[model samples]
Target: MDRNSLIMSLPFRTSSPPLNWSSADCCNWEGIACDPRVAYNNLTNITGAIKILMRCKFLSVVLIGENFFHETIPSDDSIAHSNGFRNVQHLSIIGCHLTGQIPMWLSNLKKLKILRLNHNRITGSIPGWFSTLPRLKHLALTHNHFSGEFPKELCALPALISAQALENDTNTSILPLFSIFGRTIYQYNSVSSLWPGISLRNNSLGGKIPIEIGRLKLIRELDLSNNNFSGNIPSQMSELTNMERLDLSANRLSGEIPISLANLNFLAKFSVANNNLSGPIPSGTQLQTFSPLAYDGNAGLCGSPLPKECTHTVKSNKDKKTQDEKVGGHRIPWFQITVVLGFITGFWGVCSSLVLNCNWRNAYFQFLENLGDQLYVTMAVSWARLLRRLL
Candidate 1:
């Protein structure tokens, strides 16, 4: 098809006709990016025959999301000779009417970083080739009907930082032991890729989480919530020191929480609620710091943070012993005793000084009165003797 006809067929075309498609001037077209140097040469040479498909090599982004492009992507007919979306780094086809299995050819886009295909009716097992995309950092394939055991290869991508594959059910088991006739069979043979952080919540996945998952040391978030997963949370997960969020809620997991989880000091959110777990919750920095709500709904759990305290008789005896030690260790210091004595002595000294001062003042007044009386008597006797002699 001609480039103009193909462009017109795109669901993104608006009612207002695109800028004059009379000539192949991609620079004047909206949503059409072209190499400036190519456009400059084409403008000067006045060559209107150069197709945009040939000139779109310099395209950096292609946004066809939410445009109701209902059809299989990378269809053999549609992608026969075109590399239109080859160089584009971000591909978001969210809520598009697209269907069919995820294309294996999508793994060929080496530069793709973000692939969002959420909220669609897409079905089929997740392609194993997805692990080969080296630059893939964000992937969202939620709200689809994908089936099969979780692809272990996708968890091996080194550059995979965030992945969301929630709300899907694996219709078949990938366990080699369960395959028909004891012949070792590989269900999906694609390259091995590892993702650091992933979400596989609300799926029909049942079985123990693979112990190999702990190898993802850089993983920060892991959500396997609302699944039929059964077994103790792997102690190996303590190696994920960088993990910040962990949600394994609504599972059938049982057993005491692993003490090793306390080693994850960077953990900010931890939830194992709605599980069949029992025994005292692990104690230590990370576990103790979590609110009771994070460990709630486990009927058999008991500890300091939880309302159900430990019921072991030995614990009560230990508490009593510690209390006795504390009480016995409470001894009054000599300095405090000295301080109390000093206060009492100082109070008595002040009272005695007041009484002595009062007594001295009264005695001084009485002595002055006695001396005055004696002086008056001497004066009167002398005056009377002088009067008689004069008479």
Candidate 2:
């Protein structure tokens, strides 16, 4: 393409703005480098529509970071109808302060592999069509204000759970290099090994974390922290055996921490702090290796890592129930014993008095004898009178 063609398609102004479109070679411009296969623009103060970017058929990677643009994600029909940009494999446009929801047109890039749109003002729910992308491996949407329910469709993606591809496979390809924090990344491949799993952190999004999250068995990082999400942490998340970093902090999550999470042997960085989580932290896991702050803000959480202790030293539900039974068994039945002792004392005292006192015993027998004699005399008198009358 001629310099004029490239200039017309350029949407943003770079540090070294092209002074004259008459320039024969784009390589001659400052802050711009071009290999036969790649074009790199070291840009800032960039403005205008980004739709023109989709016109490049050979463009496999579009990594634009910290560059100012017209704030359009290029979702309008004009760009969607364009025939070029069919080979985009890795697209990362981060920290550009771009506004508007993630565009629907991005779905047209059938070959898209890794997508990072974090640190932007993008709004709306994560699109369900994202699951349709067959090659999508990594997605990061942190620090956006996306407000809606967690996209259930995303958890069913098979590519995210597939075995990781070797980084060396992309060595022959031209990868974009960018700076993050204060350090410069040498190559995209070297840093992408930790391409965080579904980083939708720091948003207004609310709702229960779906149980389908556990289906990502091979995922490395899953961060959904700093949102209004409510409900118990899905026990199914324990199925992510390969997970390295898991952060669900600063949410409205409740209930006990899943013991299964403790089985994640590969876990390195983990946190569930500032949530409604309760019960003892699972024992015998790397979760306890984290500082107490990891479990802080959860009033119900207790254990070694946390300062508060459980009411009972229970290892499991069964152990707790057994302890309760033992406690109940040791209780004395004082009321029943008291009643039985009282009854026995009253009966024995009365009988012993009668036996020991001769006068009392004689009176009791004499009263029964006299009553029997009186009854016999009355019966005799009645019989005599009746016999006389008959004669």
Candidate 3:
């Protein structure tokens, strides 16, 4: 087909399609172009629906923002037969009012480097097949209703430089699965589902902090305020060697502050107030830099930044120690003396009772012996008198 015939076959939105077009007129069509690199090649097509398609081989960028193009993007299987845009490297369809799920055919663009589809009502989870795009660098899908867990496969992309996915309440557990520089950041939040590393400031996320979150060594900004997270801050969070901003305010966390958190060398903005946390605040170099507002509204917390000092904790510890020492010092000797005196007194009383009973028995035995001897003598005298009378 000639260049004009090819341009006429392509879909366009107008009252009536153009009918008259000469070979020379093909160069003037709104979306037609000819390859200048080749002396006689007339490759006519559309790009971004605005610029005339000249030199299809050399067409590298396509910007189709705010266009009236209305058609369901074909599936990957159908695009091979539909003669889809083959060579574009960058494609942006922002604010196009496009409807329906992201077509699987978009993955067919092997040369696509950047894809921007923000500010549209695109529904559906990000395609799992996007991992096939090796050269895809920048992906922007913010301000959409794409609901699901943060795709781990996307993070595994070797070429992904920047990724922006915010404002979606995808009901997936994001804490335990999240690993930035081999550290977990949602260690104490019990929320079954979390949007860790994202700006999830205003949402209905409820749960306790995952204890495995102290591993994100490279996280700079963490905004998890205005949620319903509760639990003690994990002491292992001190491992975030490069954390700069942390916001755990307006939640329901409780427990003594971990002393190990003072090891964070780069923490600048920190807040964990409006919760039920108790005990003294953690102290050290980075912790000293936080303002009073960082730990406000927690009535049970006390320390330097807070007006309530931890004298009770110190006093309680000291009192326990003193009581333990006093009990230890007095108990052994007193117990030993009581046991020894009891044994001696019990032996002397038994010996005195035996001696008195023996003396009484001895006197009674002497009196009985003398009475027996007198009875024997009286019986002998009576027998002698009776014998003499008989003689």
Candidate 4:
């Protein structure tokens, strides 16, 4: 099929008319911009993109993922020096055994709408320049080795902060970006590729989650799970009135869950498990509608949905520790009891032999009597001998 026919078969702008094969020249079709340089939507089976791919002046989409090249992402001076994939809208390189940092030249993708590099071995900090991409959306870096605090500016992206909800008609990516065992996180059709959100799950990114994140008012998915993020969740996150899924599990976050989270009426998926979060779960909200396992691994959390009830007389950590110590103090030492039992057994065994056998008792007494007589005779003889010598 011709390039135009292929592009038409996949999702593009909803306004694009149905392909009329009756027409000879595709250029005559409505909304068909015949720009000679615009050869886009490359879905090739190449192992790795060579330098020439970066030089394509009008290539619009690059989706090459799920391969076993074991090679670092290829780069060259063209990407660093000139407009690099300037018109590219979607870029995905997932599960390619890719290593090394994301090339800094990606900042050249001023028009990039979606970026997915999950399931690779990429390391190094997330580039701060990512926030500068005005049209960027739907970033996924899950299952990588990215570390360091997220750039606060990332949470302030104009598209994420105030982008209107996707209408039913907008075109989205032609391929699946996030999948587990062939199950995709989102469906193949009607879901916008430019969904306003981010996922950094299963990385080493640390530091307090940026309070600026609450500004993403229209974001649908926000996942920072299985990282080292700490500190209290921002109460301002409740402002995300349109959020559908929010996961902060397996982090070091402490303090009470923001009671304001109860206001997340649109939240379908939520988890805060395996954190240092404490206190009663906020009452009378959708938070209680979730499974108790959603709140598991937090020792200090209590109340509805959990087996631990919040008590009027709350105990402090010090008090609980002292009570535990007192209980431990009363435990009997088994080693000392064993020693006492051994001593009693030995004493009883000897005493029982003498009492049970008359011969043993008589022999014992006779030996004592003989020893006493011998000692007395020796003393008398010694005294008589001394007296004779004196006379």
Off by over 4 Å in 1: 10-84, 160-196, 313-391
Using all chains and alpha carbons, the TM-scores for the candidates as numbered come to 0.56, 0.68, 0.43, 0.64
Tens-place lDDT digits, model 2, residues 1-391: 4554455445553444456534543335554553322223434332222443453446666767566643645566765666655667667778777788888767877677678898888888899998887666678899988999899888866567565433334422444444352264534543344354688889999999999888877678888999999999999988988888889999999999998887788987898999999899988778889999888899989987887878884389877666655654784566798999999999999789889999988987898899999999999999999999999
Runs in model 3 lying further than 4 Å from the true structure: 1-197, 313-391
Pairs clashing in candidate 2? none
| lDDT (CA) per prediction | 0.62, 0.73, 0.56, 0.74
Task: Report the error of model 3 at residue 163, Å.
Answer: 15
* Tens digits of lDDT, candidate 4, 51-108: 3344455555665676534677655555567655666767777777678888877888
Backbone clashes in candidate 2 total 0
Clashes of each: 7, 0, 22, 0
Q: Tell how far residue 75 is off in model 2, in angstroms.
A: 1.5
Clashing pairs in 4: none
| 102: Cα error in model 1, Å | 2.0
Score candidate 3 by lDDT.
0.56
Query: Candidate 2: global Cα-lDDT?
Result: 0.73
Residue 233 lDDT (model 2): 95
Best-fitting candidate, scored by TM-score: 2
Model 4: lDDT of residue 263 = 78
